[model samples]
Target: MTRALVVAAHGSHYNPGTALPAWRCVDHIRQTGLFDEVTAAFWKEQPSFSTVLDGLRSNQVIVVPLFSSEGYFSQSVLPAELQPRVGQAIRITSVVGSSAFFTAVVADRIQKALVKANFPPAETAVALVGHGTVRHLDSRQTTESQAGLLRGKFAEVHTAYLDDEPYVADLVRTVTCPNLVVVPFFVAEGLHTQDDIPDALGLSDPLYESQVIQNHRVLYTPPVGLEDNLYTVVLALANEYSDSEAAADPGLSSELYWTSHQLAQFGQVSLHADALCHVDDDVNAPDLEILDTPEAIRAKLRFTDSGEFRPLPTRRDLPHGWKIPAPGDVSRWAALQMIYPGVWKVERTCSPHEVGARQQGKYRPVRDISRKKVDSLVQSVCLHCVRHPSWHDQNLESVPGCIEPCSVWLEEAIKP
Candidate 1:
């Protein structure tokens, strides 16, 4: 039976930015390739919750709300829109906040801060930042709940807010811990994590030690929903009702999943060209290369891993127009694209133009690559970048150098 996972999120009508975290979670889950389809729906955006099932062919669908609380939206609004018809099964999982293992996830995060700064528990203070809507008492309950769990382990535990009391700007005045660590209880690092909250707290940069705000130096971590272990948390949330054959690989680690190409940049690994077919081979393979025009270069610009171009074997068609440089040319391709964007596009498909659009003065039409093929490539690049050491070891500013060159940072965004 065809199965799907529809992640439901309460998106914004006024600000499209709020939906990013849910979109990110959707992207994260989709990369695992655990189901026939993984998609997203927003309550206030296009494909709103009311029409969430308008185009689903899956026999079973598991809708998991990305909310961190089981308030009115998860308990009432989302459920009201998720009715399934005969031969179509729709199962709704509990909100992510209800995950039984979340406390453990919190514990792990706290430990990382301790290890990073090696601060004495006696002096370091932990503050959990939340939306904390004063209108709804239950809204801040999750923040309170996590703070309670962390209190036993950290010397100082504080709960600050954006909408309610104990404003993050006054964190130092309210929470008297010497070295403060603020963890945003957010689904994603949208405007709040990236700006509003940081601004309130006087943070000048993202993911770094902030200049003393109100006389206190603060260290802020990335938003909570992007946690690596949260994959397990999400799977656990979906499995409460998912009967599909997909099983979570708890032991599978992306820690070393770096492609051989990435490793060769540092002389840590090698790709022997003699053992592989060269790009000049004329082996007949599927022509899945998409073109925007006759001028479009037909190379495997999409970095997918489901399989290779059967028409050509290995690096045989790589460096499409030039000789594959040395053995680790694929990584070099990524580096070249990064350091030399202008030069790298020479071999990539032409910038996609709308079909029937007038280019220069002549009308031109073009077709896109097969969705499945692009999906395969996008997933491969996503997995590669998301698991790269730079993603974890370095901050966001340093992160793009690895992604932009690889063309995984959406040089070719899927027009969802």
Candidate 2:
């Protein structure tokens, strides 16, 4: 039976760095060739939780949440979104943060800090900072549990939070150790580790590896999620789940229904002269980059034409003057996936009503806004994006419409 692994993560809509760790983990897992297929599903990014499994070809699939804790997203959101189809067997594993391998990773991170500072563990304190919330006790509990495991190993092991009591700011001010190591327990580095935590700790430099604050030498490490060995944690969780679960039906293949013939033109890309080329490229355009592989195309799309980072790949700012030589249908299809990750599956399956339903379920904040406000937001945000609104009919001859509102649209609609 063919098996698949999906790394489900809470990817940021505005910050591209938030999704890098999960993608890196997926890349490593893919290299091992442990499963028939490996992909990533994100709550706030493309190939979202609602549609990630729709095109899988595996009979048995394992989804491992890339969250750092068993909080709101891991417990509630993931289960609600990842519903399996008939004859398809799906197993959702415990969040990666709960894995025993993760505890070792945390311990290793702290050890590295101690060794670099030449500070004895008995003289230094360690702070495990987590993004805790009052809505769920699991986050705090998991963090404290990890800290508990290391309590006797160090002079003091404390748990701090961004939301709950014993907050990050308080921990920085109250901790008495002359040498403290602050390790962010986040799944990835983002606004929290890069800005909030550093600011709260009164560190002069946000990217400082070590700094003295209030006469106390403090060492700040990168978030644990960014560790190169995170794929091991994912592997451990998948192995544990597979061992306990029963065999599943060898379901029908869920390969993408659309063909390259159906993809003649996308937002700013088109098939021309047996190659997938940018709409603006011509003989006059200089510095044209030749992308020979789908991976190369994906890497190129990480930034805009003007050299700015593009957090949302669906934006209208896809760079020009680059082309993928797609002499065959397979190459064309692969190029499309790199240019528009999950659009083909969405275009093939989603109807107007289904699109509306997806939008209603995913963008709950849209309900609170007035119709006029919603229209204005859509005009400003959706119109400029590469995706056509759901109102447009899906035709292979034309650019495909979006199946639902994107995260950027939802974020703008919910703005106070």
Candidate 3:
């Protein structure tokens, strides 16, 4: 009867904006009396998934990922972190929150943005650009899924990506539409949304462009984060967990609630320690100083259960213009290296903590069992999961991209 709620998000040390919507989702759910307990976890940041379960006060819990599409973190990281046990008889339900409804929402937002700009939606070529991968076809599937629903709702719809086959550049060759409007299917307005996509479209700034990309007469909408309609996504997820179908066992719900509370306590403690590095004047901070030392990194992994993003400490005395506050992680590490090479050294690592048995667990032997179970459980959950695991775990290795840096540092060569 113990029911708990874990809303997982792909956290970034490099973008506060990425985690913002996930947090908003958790807040909306808590406002409703849906579960005996509710908590949020992240792939990065504190409240690490390693120890998220210790906080569960409900006998049953529903986990919803606040991602725009099914990608690696939703599949591999989330399942591994919430690794299920056979005999525990824990009634855990996982719902993939990336829905076709989101596509309609995005389309609606685009129509409105264009209307405000005095452009007709029927005349504009809506290009939904996503970050696609070559490994798993699901990233492309997700974009296609979005596009399919969008095409049904709108007159003109097209799709593109940053990587893999049928790329953004191909739009110039493939798309037959005349008046193009690009809408990035991304959660934030980061480098790719700002610098890379715009550059590819051949516009200095579509906001001020007198000429358009490919001489196709284009219009670029602001990244989706700036749109206000996203709140609907969060509200709908909370309703899913709180509705009448959820169990009414007070005892079970109470236990899960208490468990979630305890996990939250432990999570907050580790979160504080993890944030400590933010204030440390250590020049090696970007190199993941926490992961460099065994004990230092172990401190953050102490959570027996409970996971989610919490505030980290940053240099309080940093002067304005000295350094822009950057989210700290590997993808950002790579982006920064690509953008400002001299500012930092990029070192690739292979020994991910979540890798095989040895690096994954707190102890070597237990780690082995956990790793084995992790493999088996992932396959099992994917087969019976509410949504396709391929949709979430878009990467081939079934692991997060950022953590691969440190994990690789320990085992393999660091390549971009």
- Compared to the true structure, candidate 1 yields what TM-score? 0.55
Tens-place lDDT per residue, model 1, 1-416, is: 66778878766533434555565565567668676655567655433454446445567888888776666677666766566745788888877766676766666666677677666778889988888777667777878888887886776899888988878877778767777888888766567778888888777754555456766666787767656676567666776778866643333322222223433232111224421212343223333332222112223222123433221111111332212223354434323222112121111112223211212212222134354644554455544432232322233333122211122222334334
Cα lDDT of model 3 by residue, 279-397, tens digit: 22442345543333222232332221233222221101211111112233322332222111111111222222234443332222322333444345445433332122222244433
Candidate 1 overall lDDT versus native: 0.54
RMSD of candidate 1 to the true fold?
15.8
- Of 1 and 3, the candidate ranking higher by lDDT: 1
- Residue pairs in collision within model 1: 278-316, 279-316, 279-317, 285-311, 304-377, 338-405
Off by over 4 Å in 3: 84-98, 152-155, 172-178, 205-211, 222-416
- Per-candidate TM equals 0.55, 0.84, 0.57
Among these predictions, the greatest lDDT belongs to 2
Clashing pairs in 2: none
* Candidate 1, superposed: residue stretches over 4 Å from native: 11-24, 27-34, 44-47, 243-416
- Ranking according to lDDT, highest score first: 2, 1, 3
Top TM-score prediction, candidate number:
2
Rank by TM-score, descending?
2, 3, 1
